[model samples]
Target: MSSEVDKGSSTQRKEGESKRSKPILTRSVSQLAVAEAQHLVLWKKPLSTIYHLVQYMADNFVYLYSEIVRNKIFVFCGIIILIGSYFLDNIEGPHQALFDAVKKNGYWMSYWTFLGFLSSFGFGTGLHTFLLYLGPHIAHVTLAAWTCKSLDFPEPPYPDTIICPTQESAESVVSFWTIFNKVSVEAICWGAGTAIGELPPYFMARTARRSGENLEEEEQSSAKKKVQELVTRFGFFGILLCASIPNPLFDLAGITCGYFLIPFSTFFSATLVGKAGIKMAMQTSFIIIVFTESYLKMVIRLIAGIPKFGAILEPYITDYFEQQRIKLKLGQDSNDGGLVSFLLTCLVTGMIMYFVISTINSLAQQHLIQELKKQSKSESKKDK
Candidate 1:
């Protein structure tokens, strides 16, 4: 009886030891997995990483789609506009005629007619219309003034305007105020669009603050803290100062204002003045001065005098200017509506896609953080 009891006791002890060993091995493997995941080097396997990221986004498509459609109305509208713009560009025949008719007759008559496309270009946080659309328009106007010796105002979708300057107006003076007045409406419209683009960040930050989810000081960078401090100190003037400059950090300003629960009217009014009023005026004045005949000629001379590559570039530059002159004289559209237009459309689409992806990722991260916080609070309460 003693021997049987010893055997059974030994067997039970062995079984317990085996069970404990199994758990230890499992835990070690899991720890190894987590360590490897933490140390994943994306650059070493960029293609694979991209593939996985794309797959993950695809897998979570439904969740992302629902979030955008249900919660992010602004984002939804932006996406629609982007898609619509792409289609509109591709349309043929009647669409082209309709666009031409509007450009010729209805451009200055309706604010929407002028504002619609310019605003779209200025929409979103990163992409500014000044470089792509407005800057070129200013340059074209300046070029026209130099060549035609008139304040030949290039309208929106400019250098492609249906109504061109007449030979009769060739002797007209292209003064500073004349140029400014011609492009003033476009500048205002574009600036207003940019201000509207800024709203998303503000709204997002405000919503987070209202929900009691504030960004911790430790999570913020030093630059961000400084911006917030500046904004907090000066209020309206602070926002105006930040928005007036061509600063990329204006988005941060928007976010900070929202987080502080600044009133919409105050924030918007300040932004509008800074962007549409001050900034536009500065840009317009600068362009007008820079594109004057003597300055433009000086620039062209400098470009032609570049050491080794000058000879090669000089011909292309000369030909381009000559082409512009001929086109202006004939009152023809500079846009060929072929490869260049397609490339531009592709570029804009890519930017919009990148913005959408970034926003979705940010929202997802916030959601996860909120969930984790809730879980910790619940567990602590349970312990109490």
Candidate 2:
């Protein structure tokens, strides 16, 4: 009887141990699985999947054509053009007269220039804005280049002359200064215009309140006061940073200031300083590149005359010149003279940050609600 009792006790002890160890073993396996899943999801799998997806899209002709035709208005406009061309060909006499009119007195050029100016004003008014959506630096560079090309300025200042002007090089200095000032001032003026854009919406809101419209006065006032306080605290630095940075958010800042009745002169001064400073920096960089070509090429030639490192460096030096040419062209036409790509990148990153923050806040709110519900249920159960 004693032996049988001891055997039963040992069996019970073994069963208890197995029960405790099962959870540990299961938990360890689960943790390992979770970690492996996370590693696969985080980078390796997602990157490979994205790469394959892009490769597939690039290879699909139908998909590519569909994507191109997705712009309905543009496609419709193309169709209209085709139909219009057919009709015009049938009425060549009238079409010819219209064509001649466009050709005469540089009418076509004047028409396009007028349209450009109109578009610039219409589209560029907002807080974080560019002239016709062309970045400020690119717009300035293109304008400067066009002005120089059109006017045929005598020995129009290249970067080299601008950077290293001497007492004897008065012509180059003057030309450089003139172009720089022109571009810089234009940028400043555009900045001011954007600041002005922030005004109308705020005024309209104020007007609605005054007129006893449906707007909630207390909420509007509270929000406005909060913004005003923040702006007042930051003051000049805030304005200057917004103006200097190439982003659409600047317009909103300008509008806030206007809504709060910040002094126009003060606002203009900050904007002018910020915008002009950025433009001047860009102009200086362009001049420096030109200077480098003239001075660096001479140094490179001297080095090439040397025996050992010259051979290796020659190909590199040639490649550098080639890259500079491409850079100069791309800088003028795309991505705001390539000087302000960082600003554009910042704007995009900022937008993504805002999106992520908003999403996190939403998730946090949901979690809090769930926790509150759980707490209430526990409290009810305890009462029962």
Candidate 3:
């Protein structure tokens, strides 16, 4: 369905004209010729940032594949180890807890509950990345998202669901890769380190651009700036604290303290201890949910007609997306950007991360309301 634009259409110049002028592709003449060519050419863009990167690497494979790997082998190996860390992410007990939360509380209630869960994540990761890395490296992913949006490419992740930063292999981010690998090495050497020290606890902070929230709001330059500054001040010692605190209490204390204070300072300080703990929780929960027997029990309770309390979950999740949409200042909200329609598109595109929200809507918002009617009717009949 996607096509590359042919240079001939936009450029009055032909590739032939350029090749003829300078057969030595390395010469300045070739460079000028190429620039003239792109200026004149009407070409379709690539699908995404990652797509653009992979394409760039593909275009220069002979130069990059070996020497770059050699120069950066230590970092590469550490990144390799980080990728391996995904295997440790399951939490059978927590996974069961999630299921139990869903079943006993109702899918909807559990859904509403995740807002506190997600926002709390932002607090910590912002701190961890800023303090330890001193780079607004989080953009590594957002930039990828922007790149993907520009090109329309799907995410090119490996089969393992553990997220590796999209730009780990980017030609420009060599230092970032090195730093990230350093952290991964530390995690490995120390162990998941008291639940807070665990790397998997947090999922990469979710982006709201996907939900069609305000593009302007989502595009705010300050979010990255705040996180980066926090890093500058605290360094990783600040990070160690972030990697240790529980997210809920951390956020609870933060938001309460923050209402009278500025959002950035509140968020930045909260982040100091928030990022690592938040990520660890998610990673731990994800692992537990997928593997444990308690998971089975949680599922069983739902099937057996237990009244789950998910009344506010759908709206909560939706609001969470909206909140990020506003905070990050993306394109438009669900109301303006045809977000509901676009969300449907995501559903079709196989972004399963949103399924929980979807289930909440279908079951708790619509289905459960009807299910309750059925239960009421059966009860009345038995009473008669």
Candidate 2 Cα errors over 4 Å, as ranges: 1-170, 173-179, 205-229, 263-269, 276-384
lDDT of 3 by residue, 146-227 (tens): 3222212223331111133323334333233332342332222122222222211221111212232111111225544454
Q: Is 2 or 3 the stronger prediction by TM-score? A: 2
- Runs in model 3 deviating more than 4 A are 1-54, 68-222, 240-278, 281-349, 352-384
TM-score of 1: 0.60
Report, for every candidate in turn, its global Cα lDDT versus the true structure. Answer: 0.67, 0.48, 0.35
Supply candidate 2's per-residue lDDT for 282: 58
Worst 10 contiguous positions by lDDT, candidate 1? 116-125
All models, RMSD in angstroms: 13.2, 19.1, 28.2
Task: Give per-candidate clash totals.
Answer: 0, 5, 56
Candidate 2 TM-score, C-alpha based: 0.30
Ranking 1 against 2 by TM-score, winner = 1
* Model 1 lDDT per residue over 143-251, tens place: 7766776764445545356234654564566787877886787777777767777787788789979987644333467776777887888999999988898776777
Candidate 1 lDDT:
0.67
* lDDT of model 3, residue 200: 18
Q: Which residues of candidate 1, in runs, are more than 4 Å off? A: 1-125, 152-164, 170-172, 216-222, 305-311, 333-384
